[model samples]
Target: MTQGLDIEQMLAQHIARLKASLQQASGEGSGPEEGSDAWLLLNAFVENDPQNWHTLLANFEQSGHWLAEQGGKLDVRIVALQRYIDALVAELKQILSEQPLLLVETVERLHLLQSESIQALTRGYQSVTDQCLRDKDMFSQQLEHRLLALQRINGVSNSAMDLDQTLEITAQAIAEELQVDLCSIFFYDDMQRVLTLRATNGPRPLGGMHFTQRIGEGYSGWVAEKGQSLLVHDVMASPNFASEVQAYSSDYHGLMSLPIIFFGDAERLIGVISVLSQEPRDFTREEISFVEIVAGIIAINVENGRLYEQTDEQLRRKVHELATIHRVSSVIASTLNLDEVLQMITTQAVHLSGAERSCIFELDPDRRRLHVLAHYGLNANLVGQLYINVGQCCAGRTVQTGRPSMAVDCFHTDEHCFIRSDPFISSEIHSVLCVPLKVKDKILGCLCVYSSHRHLLSAEQMQLVNLFANESAIAIENARLYEETRRGLELKSVLLRELHHRVKNNLANVAGILSLQRRRSKSSDVRHILAESVNRVQGLAATHDLLAHEDVSEARVDEVARKIVGVASTNLVPPEKHITFKVEPCGIVIPSRAVTILALIINEMVSNAIKHGLAGQSVGRVIVRGREEDGWVYVQVSDNGTGPAFNLQFGENSESSSEGLGLSLIKNLAGDLEGQFSLRREHDLTSQNGTNTTGDGPAEYTVAEVRFPLVRRSRTRE
Candidate 1:
């Protein structure tokens, strides 16, 4: 068996040398004509293996089984070798059929050669199997190392480290795993179509490295553009590689650039991961595939980190917005002062929005112009001087459109017409955001913020400013309403005081005229009637005086009653008659219009008590009381005198009644007050014992009481 294996090895070597010599001669164009001498040589070798071809095929199948047992990488190589052996056996059978019959001695040598060829094939299979096992072991170690690196990368990614630190960690892990001189991550900016070198791990320090390349420009950019991986063994020979992009003072011999494609869609390229070697070395297929998987993991980590940053930034912005709104709302709710509210709005807007200046312009009533109402971070001279006409500038355009207006890079454009003017021209404003102060379809004005840098306000930032503007608009409207209400109240108060003064003076003049007429009257009855009329007018005039002094829309019923009783008792009761007046403390307030009628009712009742009840008597006592209960007011006037002989019913127009016209007038006044009026006689035992009495019984008293629904004015006191 050993000798046969040696012979098979020697025959395999001879065949290989013959094939090489034929191929070399063919290349030099000095070989035999096509399919002539080369065909004969190959046919002779196959004739030596004619009889044992079936045995060789069986042995090849057994070897295939053994190769299949090795599994994994050896399976494909085993199948390909078996196909080649089967094809060679068919060709030998065809060649031997053309040779017809050979000698029996030649047939014996053919069988021996066939056995040696099968042994040689078996030896070759064993050699390939041994190499596969060694490769498999090496692959296992490489896979284990890659897994450890990936685990470390995952650990860094899962940690709370920020995006930059995580990227640095990923770069270091890739460099260590691949054993490369330099590993760099280039982040692609889709908007700019440029790849910026973000993180690097190499011999050279990573400071002052600002390498960038446009898409399809350099090795990394080309990989990104093609959305594929590239392995260049020699950087100098590669057309896409640029030496300037390499790390400083480090020799770069080879480059491997892999696209950081999003996992689900391989076409969406986000960036590139590049590994460089100091020596010219060809990358193995396994190494290339390993780097591709690492690139995918890195891509996932990068995407996760980007999303985390965006979410975290959004959360921070939302928190800041809520805090700003709370602060501004607190300031707005604290006061109704318009100027103070406007000032707080502008100051807080500028501070929160990171603006160099902010101003609020109020639209005039005509809506044709904007006037600067409040401002912060602007020169005092520029505030009032900066005005915008409607449909002319940023502030005006915002009002015209009833939407927010923005002008980024304002200095280079004519978009902001307002800033083109004198005061704003010197302000050096580059960006401006103007939001209309709108409330329920009413555009009150515009709120504007100016920045010195272009594109300073993002869309989210603009939305935040708009929210603030909405709150400011509400605060401004509230302040204006408050101011208008205050002014209206002041005007009403002044008008009310003037009206009361005029009415009091007019009533007094009428009472004075009546008094003069009473003095000039010839008949005694005429003088007496005029005097009574003058006293009634004077009572009403006294009520107006009380109202004028109080400076209110309603007068205290008790105060007005006391004043009326004093004037009536002093004027009607003669000096010869001893009449004492008693008024109870009353705490009820009634409308000013009702005061005149109330005074008249008190005057008639008191005068009637003094004139008729105490006509013949020299002494009398009158009592006046007023109070409120259950939404109703009661005023009672009573006198202890020679009581009337008849009962007085309210609403009775009887002229012959002992109370006469006073009772009729009292009944009419009660009807005007929407009240119930009654006059009755009562017996007072205490009065009878203390003073004058009628006959041997207690003195009779006349009491007049009126009960009315209390119509309270807005301004009232208990």
Candidate 2:
């Protein structure tokens, strides 16, 4: 017995050391802080027979269960327990070192305990996880039920506005669809925990169609209290679930009650729904599901009706918002002048956003800085002078991120819109709202609004501002494009005028060179050829001269015809012959390409009439007439001198007459004009295959006429 007492003392000391080690590892003080979970766990192992291994293990069964219930890191606590076991085994080995057999047995028992403890820990962890999965499935089931309820409500659209009318309709529909003798709808007041009958179908209840009672008083109230469905196939014979049969009547015997629950953060007992039969009936799983779905639908519809009644002010505010945005779009679209449109946008920004001041900054070409294009409520001087670098000020930050931003007590206090320093345009300007102006993916600029007082700007107002900003960005882009196009057109006009002047000068220089060569030549044939070349060159110069003076693209045909006639009279008409020239250009103009060719043709025609027709005449009459007929421009040069060798029909010139280089040139030029040329006598009347007969009559007058299809045209006046 003395030896036994000594062994018990040794065991107690060993147990005490084990407990102390566990407590230290678990970060607990040694002064019996038994309130902690680790200490409680230690006590579970300690409050057992110290010498009897089986008894101690029996008390500490499922060590992992204890740890799991303690509710801390399972792996960490298991590690601590492992360390304690190691230490306890070493101490026990030292305490029983003299008894080799006992020492081996004690070590075996400790090893067995560790193994059992590890297995128990695994099992307990799995058990906790299984319980969590079960809870998740239960939540999913509740969610599915609520969704089915919502679907049922969706099917029952066109509900009445009045809650009483809506409940009556629901009760009638459920009764007819389910073929029940009685269907009752109960409305619940969560705060009062009371159930009130609102509507019923079929026979009336003992309490009548509308009655109120505490939540747990009757069958419907009992469903409200329990928050569960209760089905009584035989209401009178059922045990203890309900205080009394609901709607007690001879017409109905079977009863089924369901809680009208709103499954939100927590299940809320909204009301109850009941269905009854004339005979005893058992509710099937599918039938109960259907009824529960209908009950959920009733709960949602009632709640939504209440919500609908409370949102009149919100709907009114929404209408006002639509009008405001409409006003903004109209105001922004009113102008295409970039500067004026910016001004309008800034002004509208101030009005729509309720801000004290607003400004719009345009992103510069290099994308380094923003130049203020327009401003409102702020100093007008800042409009063109203010500049902010990208990522510098509130607007700059918006540009950097290409997003909408707002700051209360901005510039410094607010981190999102803060800059390195403040411009301090106004002491009243405490809040800022900045939004980026985006067109597709390109960031054109940013718009910034300032308020004098510090106040939180609602997201709705910010969104309103953003909407305007997008429209304003498009307006600005369109205006900028217009400005660019206008400038481009002006520049192009200047360039075209310059080109015509240069061409005129070049043609005049060529004419001057030809005139000099004519003076240097001794041969009369070369001189005559050079003189005609000078006249032709000068004719083209005349047309360009007219085009250069006017901003018009083509030259007046009358002007061109008169210029060529003057050149021909000055250089081609014989000195001895008293010659007269007249040009009648009946109000017409030709485009530049056609004008050049027409000038050369007229020069050749007049030269031919002078050199061949009026070769020996002492006094002569020459006339040039232009007219439009049958979609053709006709220029006729007439003279009393002899006609050319060619007749009205090409290659039909009488062999008796001579065909010179002048007449041949005229024929080729007419072809270039896509036209026809004719040499005919004034007295020749009859036409034979468009040719005149070689009569003894040398015609009294000669007429050289050319006709071309009129393709190009310009202003009739120069």
Against the reference, the lDDT scores of all candidates come to: 0.69, 0.67
Residue-level lDDT of model 1, residues 163-194, one tens digit each, is 67887888888888878888888888988999
Q: What does candidate 2's lDDT look like per residue over 1-718, in tens digits? A: 5644554455666777666666555565663364443444344443334544443344334555565566756778567667767666666777788877666655665566667555656776667767778988987886676555445545554444466766776777677656788788888876776777888876666677557768677777677778888888777665553335544556456788888888777776778898888888887776687788777677777666555554434333433443343333323323345676677668777876778788888899899989877788776654546677889867888999998888776555544332223366645677888889876668989888887768856765686577667756766665565566577876544544444554455456556755775686655655676677677667666766666676445666567778888878888877788888776545666666666678778888888888888987887877787777778888877787766554654422323234465666577667767887888877752221344432334446688888887775434662
User: For model 1, what is the C-alpha lDDT against the true structure?
Assistant: 0.69
How far residue 172's Cα lies from its native spot in candidate 1, in Å, is 6.0
TM-scores, one per candidate: 0.43, 0.31
Clashing residue pairs for model 1: none
**Candidate 2 local lDDT, residue 319:** 32
| lDDT score, candidate 2, position 29 | 60
Return the clash pairs for model 2, or none: none
Number of the top candidate by TM-score? 1
